[model samples]
Target: MSYCEDTIKKMLPKAYVRKHVAHEIYVAATHFKNLVPMMDKYVYNDGTTKDLMSLTGTIPVLFNDKTYNIPICLWIEESYPQTAPICYIRPTREMMIVRGKFISSNGEVEMPYLEEWKNGECDLVTLLQVMAVMFGDFPPVCIQPHSEPEQASCWLQFQRQAEVLSKTDGSFYVSLLREDDQPFQQDNETSC
Candidate 1:
């Protein structure tokens, strides 16, 4: 049996056979298909290994009434169905967070849901929900346009990080994954 066929059997409904892919790696090339006609522009480029599944996408998140597309990734180990996927948000250069319990600039996540991840009982959408809550709390400290000489003492910085961590919780992450209808115009002259 070909590699593509084997991979599809193990991780189908997400991946299709593609000999033309770069390096001949078969990946689930599209976003989860409960999406719309035009698919609302999801920007995830992720795939699976023989015993692993990974997803990397810049998902749009709304916090404080503002939207930010954050780069996120998750790796589901071969031990899934009983374990959670290791997940994290790729930090942009303009952002930093020194005070997150389950978050870091290096994409290390210690979220509770992930610890409680269950195979056949959990999935990407559930993972997205956890991320939303994490983003809302720490929310990626923005880079300043100008440099300031204002120096913060260690105590002050530590205190700030602590404050941010205190409010962090594993809630409000999955609210963003919605299957809304996308506006599409059908060409009346063409048919599939």
Candidate 2:
């Protein structure tokens, strides 16, 4: 086992990994040779210090009868499985970070599947698959990454997005805002 593999095994019990395929998820079912989970921490709004591990991967999202690889981050925390991993779109300097009710300007994310996490039942695979399906409604787009330091912040991109969302005929913006208020449904399992 490599360093990441070893770290994962330490984070989660070996017996549990064998039984639940947690190890498989770390490797994305052999699709990825290794998972480079960066050691990080997140302080949530509730004054909680969440120990976070982030890894980038492409999730096949079905949209318009086609599939697209959505570049995203799987932010695993100490309370994973019992709590769903926080998902974030890996934005390039050119990619406009979509700030919706569920998606924050700083790449914080909340999706229905995550809210529906059930201990010992839902794992990373199921959650990712669900996000892939959910993304059909909101297409992902990216631009060329700017080399300038000033344009590197996702917040600047969000400001630009907010401007566009504020313009009249911004029905799209309203929809996203509405979705933020909507509750995550536990029974909504219609992922392709």
Candidate 3:
């Protein structure tokens, strides 16, 4: 096996967090050669430390309502060179849409498998491939959310639900917050 795969194998056996696909994710990322572009769009380039202290970082922002995780931040942690990086969500007022000049992929409205991506068997590379196969044909567009209060309320409700469910399972709950209140420092890792 290659270095990344070997590293993943080593980590998987010692992982304490149940349901953590960290190693699996790293393995897929290293093994999949064709996914380089997509991965870079979301992840920090090799050998570079991600500066997440600004408004942007490596974490991906995905909505529970979508098919493929769109308009996301790809996050890598300081422990990444030794451990798997953690991906997180970023909430934006601008309707989250696939970043492209043309509509190549459909938003959650058309993609059904997106909502479960994080916890599903699919990893970053697989998710990108699926995005190309399913959404590559269309152009990109600005996705309008339902409404301000409606969106906030829905997010709040989901946060509550996620908390309740996560307590039973070993899953982590993510919250939607304003850009100013962003808990992490981000430095626009991605141009978009």
Candidate 4:
């Protein structure tokens, strides 16, 4: 089978396991293709692998010393070609924590600091560009009252360490990976 077919076939079972997983993989692959080349060079977090794509309106924001990639999962009807994907990122032990948002794909409820993504017009390239512009180095910093005060603090530390790390460490390092997962693959000729 052709590479695309093979990749799709390999992904089919996992996709079946969870539609979101498949979608995440697809989005990651797409984002990887569009993102990596643009980077002058940088290392990904150890063991970090791109999972399925979930629509997140959360633009990357810096508060304390850490970077938080936020996404909101909202209830979206099944209307292919018209309906955009509803995906979100929830509060995790190691990442940013937000209030009233559990990371799941069911509901139309509004979220805090949501930035309503224009899914119909968005693509992997545009998405990555958006990420780079929003969350890229030298983002404007701000403090919010109440709720995620710790998150705000984390960003401060993250940036300080990141500066030192960037200067002292190698910019290019292969990320650790599980045997079951393959690195993202890109087709130069393909368009999303």
Backbone clash numbers for all candidates listed = 3, 0, 31, 19
How well is each residue in 128-151 modelled by candidate 4, as lDDT tens digits? Answer: 444434333332221222344643
Write one digit per residue (lDDT tens) for candidate 2, span 1-192: 344455556554332433233464566534433235455676777898855655665566554455556567886665555667777876544455556656766666677667778887887766766666666555443333345365565444434333323325553421111113543222211111
User: Which 10 consecutive residues of model 4 have the lowest summed lDDT?
Assistant: 34-43
lDDT of each: 0.44, 0.54, 0.35, 0.32
What is the TM-score ranking, best to worst? 2, 1, 4, 3
lDDT of 4 at 47: 52
For candidate 1, the 10 contiguous residues with the lowest summed lDDT are: 183-192
* Top candidate, metric TM-score: 2
Q: Residue 133's C-alpha lDDT in candidate 2? A: 60
TM-score of 1: 0.49
Indicate the residue-level lDDT of 55 in model 3.
12
Clashing pairs in 1: 81-119, 129-173, 129-174
TM-score for candidate 2: 0.56
Model 3 TM-score?
0.28
Mind sharing the TM-score for model 4? 0.30
TM-score of each: 0.49, 0.56, 0.28, 0.30
**Deviation of model 3 at 65, angstroms:** 31
